[model samples]
Target: MNRWLARLLDTRVPALPLALFRIGFSVVMIIEIEQMYRFRRLLFDPMPYVIESTIPSGPLLLIWLAAVLFLLAGYRTRLAAVVHYVMAVIVLGFGALPHGEDWQGDSLILTLSLLLLFMPSDRVLSVERLMERRRRAREKVKDPGPVDVRLIHTVFLYLTIGLMYLDSAFFKLSSPMYLSGLGVWAPSTLPINAYHNVSWLMSQEWLVRPLGYALLAFESLFLFLYPVRRLRLPLLAVGALFHLGVMFVFPIPVISLLVLALYLGLVPAGAYERFTRLWRARAVSLTVYYDRLCPLCRQTVAVLDALDLRGAVAWKPLQDHAAEEPQLAAIPEEELLHDIYAVDRQGRIHKGVDTYAAVLRTSGWLAPLGWLLGVWPVHPVAQRIYGAVAEKRAREGGCRDGVCSLARPGAPAAEPAPHRGPGRLARPAAGVLLTAWLLSFVLIVPAGPLLRTYVTGDGALANRLENTAEYYKSRVYPWTGWTSHGVFMDEHFVNYRVQTMLVFEREGREPLRLPTIRPDGYTGSYNSGRLWELWTFETVKPELPLDQVERNMSRFVTYWAVRNGIPLEEGRILILQRPMDVTLDRFRRDRLADNLSQPWKEVGAITGSPGQLKVSFTGEPGNQSGLYGPRS
Candidate 1:
């Protein structure tokens, strides 16, 4: 067993840090993604579409987090590496090229991701591979390749990342932006008007020249130095020095930390392991005192104990011997026996309300509970009630042998009952409430971020045409025995005519039921096949005498299609305008004759008042008019 453990660590040592870094960085990236969603940028902006179009990322973000937690739990090394690497790239791409507007955090994660992709950290203690080996050995399957894949991947990943810095340095040699004292290391906090600062440094030809040359030289040399194992540590050490200098001058916190971590990775794995062991050894647990008598109280205590965190909570009944501990010794035996109290890991005693939050924090399940505990008025109310109960218990005659004695001399007294309250089932209720919360988050929340696009006015009309064309292509055009409706144009609307147009023409007379028509037809004639139109009232011209009639026709045509170019007569052509004169028609024949004698032209021939007429004819003569709007 010792030999096996040694062999596993040896194989996994190189990849272990890389995995740890990847897991850490990925968690931050997931948080950023959530922030983007909160800001609406995830749904409305570019990053989400670039990746989520292929994978619905809202749910995928949760999956990625779960996978990383599994990795931290030491389960499924190879699978975790693969899953982590893929997500890291989706995250990486967004930080890399044109979209990489701010590259600090993402660049580091990308580098770590590439390293983990090729590492063999899973061979050591990964739960998935270990379980598989056990199950497979029983069937006699051969074990696969060298266990040092993780190391090899890490070496390559580091080399590539070092190359990025080298290229950046090299490019600065020629970039005016870098040379004008605007180089990454330039101080953003330089005193205003200081001649030695970046603003003036750009003008110092001799100084800038050597600085540029040095940057290129150091960067280019770094690429060659990083590959040699003996020199690798020195190279990383020098890189850390450079980053530290930049951190002092420039304001790039993310970049500086990333470089520091990379340098630290060069330290021997034994050192990191030792450090973690010491940290874990010094860790302490919190102690909670809960009642064990009431059924609800006992059950709650059991759950708290189950999540006891290795010793986070210690239960003591009203009669337990632990009540005699030094911390409780300060209070009189009667006072101590009256109410429950908890001593935190720091040895500070919390008697009532504050104890609940401490227990939750210690239990490591406060994420769902925090909001409830955090609510404004409710939190204070809960705390007050808890305090009241604790004080009331204290006021009762000191509980003795699970029974109460008198507090006031000669007062009628009853035995003190066990402490119970509305929140007694907080533990069990948490499980159910947490499940419900998670379900809502998993379904409705993700669905809410799904992308949708909407357009109004002419765009909607155009989209309708496009949809109609698609329907016609896929379903309607194939089996139908109907003729194609060729396109036509008219004064008030454009039309497509099939077997429906001829119904609109009644020789020399307006069609039946034509005068009562309204836009959309629902309030008027539902079955009537009439032309529909709509006008922009917002753009109306007041002097266009017939603006109201034109506006009405616009809406009418939106609901109806008016077709033209099909000849009404075999002989002549003409122009006609029939005014709906519910009020002005009272002038009678004198009005009719005056309207007829007036010359007519194509309606759109010349721009005039909306009611003015202009028409052009290429055929024999004719005249036409049709009724519109309600008749008196």
Candidate 2:
């Protein structure tokens, strides 16, 4: 029994699986973080976009990363493993029931990896245990051979994971929505839609159903096929392929990858050792420059340098070299030390914002953030802001010493009352007002689909008849609940456009008269062929049309139409069609074509059924002249 137990159990290989799991989990988390940053969105703004939880993902990421570092160091292994499990569970739980989505395949794997980490396998390869062993050896204590208990734990963990796969498969098969392709699962389908890759996937019928079924089978029957030791690796390889396929289709979270790593087992021990030997052999020196006098500056530099793994930066005391370096010497000794300073590999000197960028680029941690900072408007604006602060610091003189001296009368005080200027306040105030207006629009607008209008056929004949009331009845509004009347028409021959004005009041109430619009507020106005008035959506105050103003007006009308569910085709008809071409159907052509030779007396009832309207339309044109006819 002892020999059998020895053959079945081994402690030396435990870290391999854990390492794989750790690496995979880190990758997934990083990818998710990057994706969020790329979209410039928080968790709640986009679909499958959930409201960010109270526990911010950023802090949680730091916690998980700290656990990884602890595990790598092999320090307090048992405690680290336990903490790792707890953290993984909390993150995975949120992912599994992500506020907007269901258990994405990625979430399932993450949850499994957390479960696997709880196994006693750590007793074999833990750094804590190794340290303890070394301490015992130094004391000349006899070495214990192996821990069988840890082997047992590994076996149990593996079995538990295999069982989880089975459970996932079972649930997937049982899900009615999944079976019907209803896309209600949230994560899977929603991501597909977001990427705009749904059409391609859906078009491939052979791939879709089979891919779904394969995922189902892989999870459901994993253990049944690979329960024993020999088949485990191969089965897991297949499982890895399944996960890889999923990753290709959808950007999954890091936790899923980490869990998959566990299933794949760890790297060969020899390979790990070889890699570590090379890594250890390489020398990395990091130099960080911090002001020795300022406690705050010193602390920040210390934290940053500590986080730097590559040792690319070397910290130098700014005051020590202030007299030596030309750039440093150019700045007063105190001023140079007051602001942050860092140098890169190329012997280039950087200060303040530039230095921060250099350090971030060196760390390879802030590439995305740096890129955003480098973008126009952001870059220039940030540069100006940083410059102002630096100038202010220079004027104040040695804020680094934690003492302040007020600006002197002759020192050209840094933009006295900086906050009071139009340069600062005007832009921000305008931004605030614009933001408020947009927010109001978003909030007040109905969530329902926008109004749509469609126009077909050449518009030439419709425009010529002008003031006839029947001309306005044909436009479509998706949000229109009741009858609509078209009142205003502004014709432009140069642009070949006809502007139709439709005022929608409550269904029962008549629209207010044009005269009631108040002349004080209405400065720029034009007559509408004795029938109505034409007011450009923009500036009743402008009283003139500049190219830029017209362009802006065009944009406003387009955006309004789109948000209100007005179709592009309809908007174009209203904006670009000639006045004569704007009619639904010409009165003189359709009605009087065959009867042109005869006197144009009252028409006889010629019965051809007009189409039944899907949505209600009140066929009333403005009291003025216009024509609204067939949609085409």
Candidate 3:
């Protein structure tokens, strides 16, 4: 047992896993940043996100992303980590990002980014490594590569997955729906889940309830399985399934995909090397067929080629191969047009995510990742996910309608251009920083109070961490509560849409539901952010007393009237809370199901007097209006 423990803790790992994970994390960060920016740069979107600082959120976010880019290139690793952690803590604490549901979705990413600092993430396939290599080559010295640490960073990463599951399981257990084994179907049924096609399965209570129980057990089981070496692969494999299921049927792709990516880390060091040595996949050649017409497809191909260290994957555009490849003609054009496929030297064919899985199989350090995904239940689910994404494939490119320069070289790519110069710390300095962090984190993360704060979002350690982290933010702009990553999808598998409408006492000017942006004839606008943003503050802001909800409503309505040029000396503003069953089958094209004004409750009211308005809000025990009346 001691020998096994030693092996488990001290196994020498290649730099590839960390590098690949870093690159993937960076890409996700950039995508998330771009998506948020496109949506007016609020942390989340269209609602209930956190970010309204004295400093405009856009510049602040750009600065945050610069740190991410630095992290991506593995430069100034310590500084980037500190910067990210500080921002994350500020957002989590003061930004009111939580808004009283559970937590925001990106919180997982923020937490992982914090833990990432302690790992040897920059040692391989990074700009830092590349610089060291070049420097070594110039000086006629052997490149020794990265050093393995005393504690297993990979194990710590594994435990985080367990922690996430444990916390989620705790919440699930607390919910009657989950305890009754209906929770699995409930989240999938939510209109907000975005997995519309498969939502039909909600009726299969047999399938869903059991799946719910299975998920609960699955999540809870891994905690015990952490120390069992023999079951590690199976544990990770099962985890892949649980997360893949969530990925397919939920809108929480950021966390689901992040977890899936990290699952690759659970494979023991040299597992892929052993697999490759056992099977001469090095001798294997792969021809990847992609719809070059799709920009996403082309970009995916470029990334795959860049990561394929074995010179094994051959990229062919389906448009170019239609005539030459007999296999292309054999498949239906409709099927071939949308989904990407791969043909191996053995004449075996793989499609969609399976094709990508095969490419990863040949790609150094990621072969086991391919193996895990290609394994039975997980593979099937992955295919479904791939199909789902494929269903929404955009044919457009950088130049629009695939009419752009995508020059492809005939040979395998060599030593990709290092996305250089994020930071310039030498290996020794970086290692020292990493070691110090790991030592501290190993002690801190598992401490009773720290764990409590992390899981519950409030505790002594949480308060201290929150306060200490504030010191790290840019002093010029106070981030006390302006930036945060709330818990991931604390929406409780329910959709809450808050609507405010003005009812004028005057003639012919009927009440109008507040449009998110400027209305056609309106000179005044109330929406600087999403509806949930306004609602989040009104319903949950602690400083705003319960009696002031009506006043808050009055403020918003008054502002809206002024902006829209509506003559409103005395118009009542009603803050309506529309709570919909996320798990119910509301068959409508709009995410709101085109059902508005129905099933609405007046959570808060603003009475417009001749001179000024008085605002008030009420909440019942079961409701989450963020306003709780005096306890009975």
Candidate 4:
């Protein structure tokens, strides 16, 4: 077991996975911060009516922004990760007090960034790496790539994501609403959905049922299949498509995009490597060295062979007499294990992202894409993305005969996986850390509809290990009820079912209106068209007391009046709510064609009886109105 474990860690791969992930995650953190800043008045208002926060929003935001900048620059990165997570806890945990904000995306970012803290993310184009290069002492004892450290990071990453999604699937299976697909159908048909214009396509039962089942499968099955190499890319591709559909079809905010960004790490670097080699039908200007035994590469070779109309490139499998190839002889064998090497016409060597792009340029249609990838600014990111894919491909390629064992191109193939050194992560202390992580993983073990069917329940260890770890999150964690519960619910409330159109008027002048809620402050009035979140938070809340919705709206107008200098107590605020019977049927029949038709006719205030319904606010604060959580 000891030897087997060592070999597993010794498997050759690149540092690019963690390094590239660090870059993408930092960008996401920046965007979250920017969005919050853009809608400060709406999101961060400190009035008693707003959700109470544990810490000062200003300082927490400043600290978050500072940490994000350092993290993006890869300066003191581990420190940044620590700071980043600390802020997440403060904001998402405590700041989301009373009732939680949608915290799934924030939780994911926090967890992933926390994993980076344990890995060497500062090894790439980082300030720390550059500083190390300047020190003569550091140059003497160079560190071998920390493949073990990389594996540890990967373990933690999968462990976190797997637990979350698997539990989601479990909760989904437990929900009856999800079984019939009404959970998804309800939300997609709502006005809030950005793609409502085309969302009617899912009205087909065949499409909706399969889609519901697909989400359950994607979230649950991916956890098990993620570690398999041949199946890895395909799974990630499907996952990306799933998230893309979610992004447009629902109003789930930025979580889907964050998941898509993380999936960037799953794309193989050599995706274009050997495949483009066979496209050459003319004189060969470039020679590509690849493993002919690799199933993935062989398929690519066949496709390229079929596609090759002009012989412009040569794809050569690394034969026993690899050294006999003139230019290949000079290249080191160990590096070849991690990358597919390419030799140009003038004996110029190309590998990694550059090699794939160079060879791909031969195809007329793909030439533009290749050129774009090779450009200086774009190539850096492209290189890392390719490295992420290639490293995984090479790791899973497996040793063929003894040929893959050779450390140099000319040397005889004699080994399996290469073990270069006693890397830092292989130390006893590192072993202890890994052991602790694995032990804790048990508490969050997998068991859901997918797992229970085959692995547990009536299967092997049914009683010994719980089939699912739902109790801890679904019940134990208070906030998680809000944060995580909606995975497979058969029905999501259509927020637009009761839309409120607020038209405010001063004593003498016309009720002022603008395109939408201006970020600056309240104009005279706004329609219910684009104020989905704001209006829904305040008025569409049915669970609240009839007076509770009024209090919430009044607080908003009070704040708005403060910002825009309006005497709110003397003004009239007209409220109109769209009923479900009228709106839902109209939506099904018209499919957004009659979107401009107001639901006010069905539920709006009586047009002629202005004085019948007169409600007044004293501008005095009482109990804060609860919007996100009416039950609380």
**Estimated TM-score for each candidate:** 0.34, 0.34, 0.52, 0.59
| Lowest lDDT block of 10, candidate 1 | 493-502
Tens-place lDDT digits, model 3, residues 491-511: 433433333334334545666
lDDT of 3: 0.55
Q: What's the CA RMSD for each of the models?
A: 26.1, 25.2, 15.4, 13.8
Off by over 4 Å in 4: 1-12, 48-54, 96-99, 133-149, 181-184, 193-196, 203-206, 272-485, 494-497, 507-539, 545-551, 562-570, 581-598, 601-632
lDDT of 2 by residue, 98-141 (tens): 32122233334344444435444444445555654544333333
Q: List the candidate 2 regions with Cα displacement exceeding 4 Å.
A: 1-15, 22-41, 44-61, 85-117, 121-149, 174-213, 253-256, 266-632
**Higher TM-score: candidate 1 or 4?**
4
Better of 1 and 3 by lDDT: 3
| Candidate 1 lDDT over residue span 412-442, tens digit each | 2343443323234433443443344233223
Give the candidate number with the greatest lDDT.
3
Residue 319 in candidate 2, Cα distance off native in Å: 50
TM-score of 3: 0.52
Q: What is the C-alpha lDDT of each candidate?
A: 0.40, 0.39, 0.55, 0.54
For each candidate, how many residue pairs have backbone atoms clashing (under 3 Å)? 23, 38, 18, 17
Which model scores highest in TM-score?
4
